[model samples]
Every structure is written in structure tokens, then in C-alpha cells.
Target: MMLSELSRFGLDPFLKMRHMQDDMNRLLSGLGTATAQAFPPINLWLGENSVVVTAELPGLSCDDVDVTVREDTLTLQGKREPKVEGENAAWHRRERAYGSFSRSVQLPFRVDPDQVQARFADGRLEIELQRPEADRPKKIQIKAA
Candidate 1:
């Protein structure tokens, strides 16, 4: 008998996406000393007139992170260190992500380079971009074909 990780959640589209993203992120960014190196998973969503990017960067402060945008690509780079200060006791097992990491994503469309906004809170970086109105698609309803 074999069981899969996704099978645990049954059938849920949102959950499936979340799980896959997590797996891919983890697989790509393995840990250095710890079990895993936190890379702050990211997700991009489209809005009516903009695209929002949210990243899960746990155990990281604004000072340790750097964000750079070039043309249509947004890059995030930083180092993650173990928060457990002063290692003591004979620990048999440790699992966490700690090391330098960077992630860059190319946006689908060129957005308002001036109207971009970013905020970090609760171990998450949220970036908002005001998309160009010209790039948005227009749909026309037809009563009869």
C-alpha cells in the first residue's frame, strides 16, 4: 500500500496548488545546516488593474532582506539564519532553513513602475503593482452569434 502527500487532503484545488508550491520551493532550496533554508514562498495574483505578489518569509526582518526591480523582473535576495541563539544541549535533530537565498520572477506585463508598493508584516512581503490599463483584456458580450 502506497500513499501520496497530496492524497492526505482529498480533493481541493486551492490546497493542491499550495502543496505543490511548497514542495517545489522546498525541493529547489534545500537547507545548508538546518533541515531547510527558508526562502519565503511567493505567490502572484492578478487584480482588476494590477498584480499582487505575496511572499512568506518567516523569521526574517526587513533589515535582512533586499528587493530590486529591473524592467519586468522583481528580485528578492537575503540571508536566513537560525534564530536559536547559542546552541546548547545535545540536540539529536534539527529542522529549519538558514542560508543566503534569492528569487526572481518576471511579471507578465509591464506595470506602473512608479505606483508599486511593498509591505512586510507577519513574516510576509506583499507587493502591489498598478497594471497598465492598456494591457488589460477587454471582453465584449454578444447576444446573438
Candidate 2:
């Protein structure tokens, strides 16, 4: 009754391999796929006392996005749309990505929630968070007798 039920009759190795890869990619894509072609490609870097997050947010002005920091997690969420303003021509290929995306990442250290700062430049949103003062290391001085 099913096509797979007849695979034993004529199974092609190449087709089977391609199908397997496609299935796996579908599974991973559901779990927050991060690809270059995907909308809002995000990059996160952790430092000793800070975490820097950079996301590609094309067509978004400084006011279109918002950055929120809570506990040791950093969340980036935004939306984009495709707009047409000029006379349309025969469309051959359109590769620009537009959609709503959200990503939350855990930092290596507890940050100062009140002192967090976010800036957008050249279509990239950068978030800089300061670590808690109490969590930073201190230097001790030695005394001679």
C-alpha cells in the first residue's frame, strides 16, 4: 500500500541517501536552525566579564528592534517584512530573507542587568553586558614587615 513497502523490490542507494539527509535537516531546522540564508543570523561571544551578541537585522532601524537581558540569559527578538515601493519587473530570483526570529543564549557569567547596553550599527544589532561588580576578581596587596 505504501511506496516504502515496495522499496525491497527496487531500492536505489542514491535516492535513499538523499532522502535520509533531507529528513535530518528538517529535524534540525525545527530546533532553531542557524544558517546564513536564514533570517536574522545571530552570533554570540562570551568574554570574561561580558557577552557580546551580534545579529544581522537588515532593513531594521535602531527603533525597530529591542534587546532584553534577564538573569544569565540574553534574548534577541525581532520582525521584518518585504515591501515593494517601485514598479515591479519580471522577478527571476529573490534571495532576501524576512521573518520573525527569536534566540536566547546563556552567558558564562552573571551580568549587571541594569547596566546592559545595546546599539545598532550597519544593520547589525550589538548587545554589550557588564558583569556584576561583585563577581569580578580583585587584586590583593602584600605588606612587608
Candidate achieving the largest lDDT: 1
- Cα TM-score of candidate 1: 0.62
- Each prediction's number of clashing residue pairs: 2, 0
Model 1, residue 104: distance off in Å is 0.5
**Among these predicted structures, which one has the highest TM-score?**
1
Cα error, residue 77 of model 2, in Å, equals 1.1
lDDT of 1 by residue, 1-145 (tens): 2256556757444786899999998776775544433366789998778889999888888888888776678889999987664656565676666788998889877777787898999889999987766767789887985
lDDT of 2 at 41: 72
Clashes by residue pair, model 1: 36-97, 37-97
Model 2 residue 63 CA deviation in Å: 1.5
